[model samples]
Target chain A: MEKTARREKNIRRQVLVVDDELVNRRLLGFIVSRDYEVIYAENGIRALELIRKNERLLSLILLDLLMPEMDGYELLEILKADPALKRIPVIVLTSEKTAEVKSLQLGAADFIPKPYDMPEVILARVRRSIELAEDNIIIHETETDVLTGLYTKQFFYQYCRQHDRYCIDMKMDALVLNINRFHLVNELHGREYGNRVLMLLADNIRTLLNETNGLACRCEADSFFIYTPHRDDYGELLAEYAERFRSAIESSRISFRLGIYENVDMSIDIEQRFDRANLACTNRRSTYTSSYAVYDTQLHERELYNEKLISDMDKALEEKQFRVFYQPKYNIKGDKPVLASAEALIRWIHPELGMVSPGAFIPLFEENGLVQKLDHFVWREAAAQIKRWKDKYGRTVPVSVNVSRIDIYDAQLEEKLREIVRSNGLEPNEYLLEITESAYTDNSEQIIDKVNLLRKDGFRVEMDDFGSGYSSLNMLAALPIDALKLDMQFIRTICSSEKDLKMVELVIGIARFLNVPVIAEGVETEEQYLLLKKIGCDIIQGYYFSKPVSPEEFNKLIEAEQKEELLC
Target chain B: MLTIDSLREYGADVDDGMKRCLNNEGFYLDLVKSVIPDTRIAELEAAIADGDLDKAFETAHALKGMYSNLALTPLSAPVTEITELLRSRTQTDYSGLIDTIKKKKAELDSL
Candidate 1:
């Protein structure tokens, strides 16, 4: 019954009173203070000051009308004027009961006839005010994202509908900027870095908006919606803003492609506007350009093409539209081949569009968000080929497959690759996962983690396409990889250009120190192959020995190797 | 003379509605914090003090929500009322009930 009694006490109504007159304030203070948490204001000014200072503690105020300097009438006007301060129940306690109606009109809670009200009547009004305040707090929490303190998507929609805030009808230029490949950044760089980037980007956007007289809103995640009211000069403003964004991107050294659309005439709905901008980004990404594009008719066509590509890609995965071709790696130092590791390269034979080079379609697959699936398909296929090579050659020659930066962005990527290899019953040592050097430079730690995970799982990680990008040597020096694949560009020019030869010599020297094998790619001529041999390249792969062959042709090459081995 | 029953009867009609209003204001403030590039919460005070009617009204509208919720219905009206009284920068009414309400508010808090 104690608990029940406490519960009852909690529900019991309470009020708060403020007054300055020692007797008049206390008389009222005393009568109502019993049923409430009685508070005092010695004078009208003190009362206003107290209320202004601690507005939350108040439920109601029994304001006296006649007071020196700041009277009850003045306080009432002020209270009624403030929406938050106005709601506290206030009964005008004054000598003139005849002014009760006027006091009510001035927004008083109630006019208690001045002589002294029955304590019960005063208590009743105070209880009424406290009940109202409690309900308001509950409603506020539902419509917002607590962390970012932004309006939830639900509230955003309401604002859009009622205020024409984001609608085309407003003739405003609202652009939604989504951070490109943010998930990859999150996976490869770590969430803390991703969040820091977001915060910095938000600050920069705000500063830019203020400078350009534009308005920006954080819509969700890394996506921000910006609205500029100056419709007549939007084009000029956008051009100016683009430079700022470009400089910010370069300074941050983060690769991103942006989508922007300006609607001056309020010509479309929010969905269409967002869709067009997304389409523009899709087209821009397909072309591998790190530039922002405004939506146009071409964006719509690009969207359709992207949609078709995604749909076709699902079928492509199942029907084996993809095939693995092996470019043979040569053991040039021994004069004859000591080992021949196959470089796993993919070719797409689209039914309508035959012979799609990976260069032409690989980006589309990545932009259409199918790179992970492609990676999976390639992993399983390459594993099967490795199994076949072991069976035929009686030796498990390791095959290296190039994993796109997109594939490494998933934090679970190692697990996925491990699962596929385990399911295929293939030894991890027989396969190498090659990731480009540029992939690690922007997000070194994340790539390091990925490489560490793969190495722990007994797979060799090769830094592929090395020496062609800004991050190549730095990453090679930093990352824990077993091998480095020198880009064909360096190898191709080694014989023709002294600068290329010097760089190749430097790369080979570094590889020796790191104890990582260096593989020279694109060794097309006898001079290039001999130069790489003299430079101490552990492996060489190019048209000099053989072109990338189909599985059947590779099997034939393996058969020829068997005969050569017998002859040896 | 006020009684518990009388108090209940007086505020029962608008109690929930007032609470809902206050909550809505809190939510708007939260949204402003989230999306505003530089977070312009301090600017709101200057707008109210300087008698910028539009800025003051917008802020009052938000506060009115909270005031209405606490059943401090009278407190919520100042922004709207002052906004009207101060039509422009020079016309504000800085007297009487507004002051009274503030005092009563202090007394209420002490309770």
Candidate 2:
């Protein structure tokens, strides 16, 4: 019973019957009134007024060609001009065969003969046209984003897949744009304001499109994708777009990062093209000077390398592929060279690539947040080596392992370090912690507190690469550290530039005044070693003494130094 | 009364015409009665007198469709002739065709 009621209600939607003659209007109304709620208009002008008033409730229109004040053609021109009104199908009710053909050419859905001869044929044609129009409205709604009227991501990809040949023939390029820190805009403003901004952006992107061919899509939040014919100079085009965006959201101070991938590999899927362009956009995340990047072969290789490293990292740790190398620091104040301490550095020996430098993998691991695990591994290995040396030689020099910024944030850092020391039967003083100078500059209060906590627990803390960072002098005054390792760049240029030499001397003097020992790293010449020692530097570590060596070689050097001390 | 049988007597295929109207014979009869007095004939004559060939063609064509729908081919044939001539912008005298339509329309109205 409900189904029958719904059917009756569905079929009773208003159908507009327009004719200049009252008799013809009444005739059409009499034929269709049983299935529809018929509305009559004597001329096209009145029909248009009725259509505008009942645009939402109207399902179809039956229009006679010979009307006054506004002809059927004139009314159709107005209706089709409006996006909202065009969804309602208009079927021409004309007596002339020529008018039927001409009406169809002017975007009419179908034609019904006048004089009410074929009531059933007219009804069937009207029903079919309404059904088809409704289906089109549903499809259009699903394929478009309601907020921006831009193609949705799924439809955009499907369109690209279907039109691949068109793109190749046109020499198109794919560009992905991201609003930098857009979430901050939503938080600072409101979500409604963000929606308005997106709508404005969509309008601007539409202006950039070609009339017939190009497409722009809203891929996801704050990201827009476009495919257009390749421009001769994309950098200039992107600059103009960036400037436009900057002006559009002037108060928000928003910027855009655009990544472009020229369509060279036609065989690749459209989604892969978007992925490559997105990867290019991510490459600009850490940079501040530029807002656009084009995907190239070098970045592709680097991306592949990063993927390989991420997949291989766990296996590398389990297989013990990582080795720790120790660079010995000598106590330069003594007449005879004596071992004071060492810095433990990590090295990776890939099964296929031989030895991989820390430069290749450390930054990659740090980005992926896997450096903390590697840091713990290095700490445990260095502590165990120190314990072994103490057991064998009856004495042991403390070795410091480099800790990354990611490790400092770990809540388990203190407990993990203590566990490693206790498990190896080593004293807390036996292992030292070395943190880069720049790490102290980030969240200095927290880093200072952590360092203080570690020092109070008996572990010596040293600042590495001290002179390289901007806030070296300020950190020296603020941090509670035992020693300072001078940056290698300062030491390397000291022999060449007298100003650098003077800077080095001043640094050592500051360390001395602070009652902290100073170590100069990367010393390569005898003259540099002599000059550092003469300047009251307490320790030196570089190629001049010895390069970073394997654990066994470092133990042999320590044994040789002990024998030399006995002879002295 | 101008019934379906009367329309059939005037060379109108009432049976096929009724089928086209979804067998609504009363509706078809009412349409014929309504079209007999439509002012479009005067509009067509005025358009021809004004030398507006486009308007003349449109009015004649509309009348032709009305006659054809009722299957009144005898009335529709002469209007179709005038419509085609005006549509093609042909320089020909339409007096003979107009006379023939007048005669047919008088017969249709008499029914």
Candidate 3:
């Protein structure tokens, strides 16, 4: 009894009874109102008004065909035309069999003849129609996002899964769009405004995809994913969408980064396809020139390489696979070259891969925030070698170690360096610090402050890779440094081109005037070495003298140089 | 006086008609009385005079449905003929069929 009452209460069958004749309306009302709440409208005009007002409460409409002023047929057309009202099942209560057929063709739910048809028949048809409409509403709610009316992420994945075979047969592409710096926008503007921007973006995406067989979903905050069949003009379509998005959010200046996976493997899950696209998007985030990336085999291979290198870094460090090689700098003022200083470079020898160049892993580590660990290890090892050299030979050449940009932000940098030097019983000035010119790009003021503090504590600071960055000259004037290491590119081309040779001479001349010595690196040939010597460059460190060598070989070289000096 | 037994005595299928009304006798009786007072005959005549075949067909069809619901087959038969003619948009004199419907409706009202 309770279930029956509850079910009846939830039925809510409010039927609209439209007729011109009072007797006809009264008669139908007497029969139907027992089971349903009947709303009477004398004609189609009044029926339309009631429909608009009580659209939500109304489950079905019982329209009479012979009514005046907007007949039942005309009203049916109007209801069918409206998306909001079209879902309400309309039962045409027409006397004419012809009208019944006509009404059904015009999208009516059912037709009941007038003249007081069986109340049971009317109730049965009405109840079934309402039930079906309610079911549809429930399905619609679950499948769509309330704000954007796009498919929800779960529904989208389900749809893709269901149509996976179709997609593979048709050759489809999946694209993921991510808004750049969306969190910053939310931080600057309120979340409401951010939601408005998202809505506008969704509208633009829908418009762009109107012509294609595509499915779009709001995957997460500020991210939209689309799967579309492969089209010949897919690139053009994306470009157009980018243009539209830029216009829509012009005030916010919100831009989208898109990643597209065109070569889809049917065997993989749809989420995996989206992951590949997202990976491609992340790869292009730092680039300013392009707003999109296409996932390919090469990018996948590079990603694998990065993963392997990151995983192997700690093991490589623990095993002491990393060795410090010293490249000696020569002071060429006299006929016999004198060893002035050496730069400490780190070399990695992987057990399986043999020699892994610094270029391959250094940038990778820096990106993953692991380069700082490598930097500290190199610093400590180099300091220990300096101490060993001083103890064995009674004197040691000053060695400079590279300090990455990430290391410059370390608060204990100065303290760490002082500790390392003091533990070795060497003056801070005896150990040189080589900072790249590009490291000044990040927080130049802080870097300059740190450099000044290091110099005040008696450590020699050399600006490495001069002329390689855009603002090298500007930094040179403001930076307090002991020397400038000219980039190898300048030395490499100096022998081939007079223009390069002139540029090198000009740099050397400027360094001399500033009372800072210049060390020319990458001097592989005798001709390049003679050019540097003639230009009065203070130090020459390149392949011509010696490549970076192991600590024992470096010690032998230094001893040999001492013997040669004694002979002279 | 329009009782179910009396309807059956007048050759009306009261059982079928009552079943169509979900076996509610009161509601079925109301439907039968409602048809007795209908103005469909006059409406059908005026529609024919105005040459509005759509409206004519509508009124004729309404009369047919009312007679059929009460199981007044004789009254419903002539109306059905005229309704179909109007539905096909064929120009023909409907006066004879309209007269027969009036006679039969009066007979049903008396019963």
Q: What is the TM-score of each candidate against the true structure?
A: 0.42, 0.62, 0.57
Clashes of 1: 76
TM-score of chain B of 2: 0.90
Candidate with the larger DockQ of 2 and 3 = 2
lDDT string, candidate 2, A1-568, tens digits: 3643554465567899998766567666776786789998988899989999999999899998777689999998898889889888999986567788889887899988655546766767777787788778887989998899999999988887777765456677788987777798788898987887888778877877854367889988889998776765766765776677668776656667888888646777888888888888887784333378888868798778778887888999999999999999999998866799888989999897689899999999999899988998899889988988888998887999988899889888888898999999988888899998898888788999999988887888988888777665666688889898899998998878999999889888888878999988999899999988888889999999999999889988998988888897
**C-alpha RMSD of each candidate structure in angstroms:** 20.1, 8.0, 9.3
In each prediction, how many residue pairs overlap at the backbone (N, C-alpha, C within less than 3 A)? 76, 0, 1
Answer with 1 or 2, whichever has the higher TM-score.
2
lDDT of 1 by residue, A1-568 (tens): 3643453366533344544444345345555655567778766788888787768776677776655578777888888899878757677765454568778888876666543445566555555444444444544665655544444555554555455644434555556666667787788788887776676566666676677555555667777666555345534544454455567544444544556666533546655655665665555662222456676866466657666666788798789888888888877668675656888888888897788788766788777667878877778888888887777677776788878887778878878878877776787887889898778886889879888888999988888888867775555667798988898788777878999899999888998989988998888888887778887888988898888889889888778888888998
Candidate 1: stretches off by over 4 Å? A1-307, A472-475, B1-111
User: Model 1: per-residue lDDT, tens digit, B22-78?
Assistant: 324443233222222322224445665576757655443334333333334344355
Error of 2 at A461 (Å): 3.7
DockQ of each two-chain model: 0.02, 0.28, 0.24
Clashing residue pairs found in predicted model 3: A118-B20
Q: Candidate 3 at residue A207, lDDT?
A: 75
The candidate that achieves the highest DockQ relative to the unseen native structure: 2
TM-score of model number 1, chain B = 0.42
Better of 1 and 3 by TM-score: 3
